[model samples]
Target: MEWLVPVLIVVALVVLIGIYLWATYNSLVQLNVRVDEAWSGITVQLTRRADLIPNLIETVKGYAAHEKAVFENVTRARAETLSAAGPGAAGIAEGHLQQALRSLFAVAEAYPQLQASHNFLQLQHAFVDTEDKVQAARRLYNGGVRDFNTKIKVFPNNMFARGLGFTEREFFEVADSGAVSAPPRVQF
Candidate 1:
């Protein structure tokens, strides 16, 4: 009877450990998926904003025909932002796009008539809404990255995470907030 009790205890311990390992692995996998989904949300929002750029540029062009540099910069930035991959590259590309947009709008400031145009007004509202979504998506993405990073770095979970291929993620950030070359102030 004494031997039987010890044997059963050992088996219970082994089973408990197995269950714990399985649970931890599942949690890590779920978190990894969340991170990926969050990043996709950001990409979707950015693409939405990018799609709006052409119409905005054309509307501004009618009034600021001489602002060739601003138009080119916006166009180039939009392309770069669209092509950018990963958080690090995407964030830098987006910041450049933001600056370019700010300058474009600043140029728009000179044309009161353009600002008053129905098309311009509608585009402005759409851009603002998309930007808001982008900001929200960025926050959600960063949160997911933070969660995944934490899971892969912490005790016990880290051990399982390593074997499971879970790894830390980079947060999306503006590379140079204080850069003298500022993006245009994008909002109304």
Candidate 2:
């Protein structure tokens, strides 16, 4: 029975290793899904904000008909924000969009009547609410990425993560974090 003892020990070790791999793989997949959901949340908020832009631009345009450059810049930035693909691309697009929006708000400030219009006021509130949601979504996405990256990089999981087709996720970050983190200050 000497050979039998060695054979049982080998089988036990193999089974333990198999269990570890299974658990690790499942955890990685779950984390990946979470990250994807968080990203989708961010995109949904961004799209809502993008939809608000045209109305905002039109409202501003009604008052400041001569500010063609500001209108065009805002439109271009909105398009970039809509078409942005990944976290890195989205970050850059967000910076441009924020700058364009600041310029648009600056134009609005020059026209007190535009700032006082009922439609402009309502749209401004909606945009601010959507911007808040967008920031929250970005925080959620980055948090998910942090958890997912930690999972794949930890302990024995690191050895098998790559082989299992798991990799670290990128955090959603903007070029000007301060600008994006806060709602644009639209002074009335």
Per lDDT, the best of the predicted structures is 2
Worst ten in a row by lDDT for model 2: 178-187
lDDT of 2 by residue, 1-188 (tens): 89999999999999999998998899899999999999999999999999999999999999999999999999999999999999999999999899899889999999989888999999989998998899899999999999999998889888889998998888888878766665467758
- Compared with the true structure, all predictions reach lDDT values of 0.87, 0.92
- Evaluated at residue 52, the lDDT of candidate 1 is 97
**Poorly placed runs, candidate 2 (over 4 Å):** 178-183
* Candidate 1 lDDT, 10-91, residue by residue in tens: 9999999999988888888898899899999999999999999999999999998999999999999999999999999997
Clashing pairs in 1: 99-183, 99-184, 102-184, 102-185, 103-184
Backbone-clash count (model 1): 5
* Position 186, candidate 2: lDDT: 78
Model 1: lDDT to the true structure? 0.87
